[model samples]
Every structure is written in C-alpha cells, then in structure tokens.
Target: MKSTGFTLETLKAKVQALTRPERFVHILRVAELAQAIAEANGLDAQRAYLAALLHDAARDLPEEELLRLAPPENDVERSHPLAVHGRAARRLAEAWGVTDAEVLDAIEGHVYGVTPDNRIGMAVYVADVSEPGRGVNAEIRELALAGRLEEAYRQAIVSKVTYLKGKGVPVHPRTLLAYDAVLA
Candidate 1:
C-alpha cells in the first residue's frame, strides 16, 4: 500500500465526512487515547492517531453497506453485522489510500481484538475500550498511559471476554484467539 498523500487535516475531514457525528466523536476520543498511549509507549503517535481515526469509519454504516465492503464469512458476522464493521472500515481505509499495514490492522482488529505483535494495533485496541467517554475500564486506561501496554492489553481482553460472557453474548472467534494469545 502506498501513502494516500493525505495531510492530517485532509484525513480528518474525510473521516468526519464518512462517519455520523456521534460515531465521529467516538473516533476522535479513541484517536486521542491511542495517540497518548503510543506516545507513552514510545511508539509512533501520529501513526496510532491515523489508525484510530479510521478504525470506526464504517461503524455506523448500514448492515448492507458494511456487507458490501467486506462480506461476512461466518455466522457471527452474518447475524451481527456490526461484527464486520472493522473489516469494512479497513477496506474503506484502503480505498481511501491508507498504506500502512499496521494502521489497517489496527483499524480492522479494533472491533474484535489484536495480535500481541501489533504494538500500534494493541494501543488502538486498548484505547478503544478504555477511552474516557466509555466511562469504564479506567484501570486499563491508566495502565496504557503508564506504558504498561502488555498488562493493559491483557486486562482489556479479559474484561471484554468476561463482560460478554456475563451478558451471554457470543464472543467473536477472533476475540477468543486474542484472549488465548494473551493467556498464553
């Protein structure tokens, strides 16, 4: 993938245009936290911000539109179209000229979970779940801010699985893999 040659302002405007106001607000919050965590962890804050900004680009899109971008391959994504939003967002980002695999992976995996190897993606994942506006996972947020990325990501995945299991919601298969990876 090659650079879209997009300046930050242009990228922001494009994302803002693609997303609903509420969803865009959430994206901004995630981007802020991701950038903070990246800075704290000595990663590329600008890259993290770019990834986070695009992570939820398709979150508010209609199910049909989401499927159109990235068709469901399994029952979870088929029944819960929202599960496909991350993949759709990735495709959308690709179409919009995002060239970084880490960025694209971060955007796609933000909705489920990320590989431990993807440091930027891990930051984005933790930030997405712990960002202030969510009003939950403060400890995880603090850990990430403290540069304890491994611990923060571990806690985030555990919290997610625990919450979903408690609520009787089926955990996405990819999420299960992330959980297992953290445990391993």
Candidate 2:
C-alpha cells in the first residue's frame, strides 16, 4: 500500500473520515471504474484509482470551507459551490502526500472538467459520472471499458448537459468548454 511515503490504507482512512458512508461508497466505486478505464486505455491504473478516491475528498465540506480552500474561478462555480470540491480536492490530496501531478490534476478536475491534454484526468472524470451507482447511462461505462475513452467522456458530458437542461439548470461553462475540447 505504501508508495512514495503514502499508504493506500492511510488515504482510504482519511477519505472515510472526510465523507459520509454513502459518499465513501461512491468514491470507491469511482476508483474502481477509473482503474478499469485506465487499464483498458494503457494508462496508469493506480494513479487513476488514487485520483478517483481523492476526487471527492472535499465534497461534503461546508460551503464556507470549500470556498476557503479554493475560491471559485467563475460564476457557475461561485453559484454552485459544491462544484469547487474538485479544486479543493487538490489541496487535500497534497496534504495526504499524493505528490503525483497527474493524480492531483485528475482529482482537481474530476467534478468540473479536465483539460484535453490530461488523459488520466479524463479517465477519472468519465468514471465519476458513469459509476454504476449513478444508475444512469450504461453505454458510457461500456465505452470506457472498451478503451474508447474520449467517446465515453463526450457521452457522459453530453448526458450531464442534457439532464441539466431538462432540470432547468444552467450548464456550467467549464462543461461546455470540455465538450468543445473533446470534439476539437
């Protein structure tokens, strides 16, 4: 479990303490899915699992605390403060001794959107949305497992946007940018 002075068990304990039981289960599922996607795509499965495990580390924090940890970067993030968990997660991961830049970047971008250049980040992002517990799209999970990462990620984002629109919620700009980047 020890890797570069960080223990997987230690990180899991920290995550369990930070999240509720349900959220902790969700985190584990995301990690599992991320690992599968990473392995299928020839990426680092361990890094992907670590990133997914820590991606929601700060999600249940108080709104004030999340804002304090990482100030919102845009109007959407400011209005929906929970979205900033991704950004705040980077700090938590770093404090937990997760020094890999790829892992941190994946955790930081999992909630909002990852840059196209970060394959690990993309895997984490896709896995978070398509995790089985979400009970939404099954095709995204299939695409990810099949190694069609970009396609899976695009479908996940599109499904999210569509759902938001149906709910009369404004889509976050970062998501739109992510969708565009994937297609470009």
For this target, which candidate reaches the highest TM-score against the unseen true structure?
Answer: 1
Q: Which stretches of candidate 1 lie over 4 Å from their true place?
A: none
Please give the range of 10 consecutive residues that has the lowest summed lDDT in model 2: 1-10
Tens digit per residue, CA lDDT, model 1, 62-140: 8899999999888888788899999999998888788899899999999889999999999999999999988999999
Local accuracy of candidate 2 as per-residue lDDT tens digits, 93-142: 88778788878888988876777778899899999988999996678989
What's model 2's overall lDDT?
0.87
The collision pairs in model 2 are none
Give the TM-score of each candidate: 0.96, 0.93
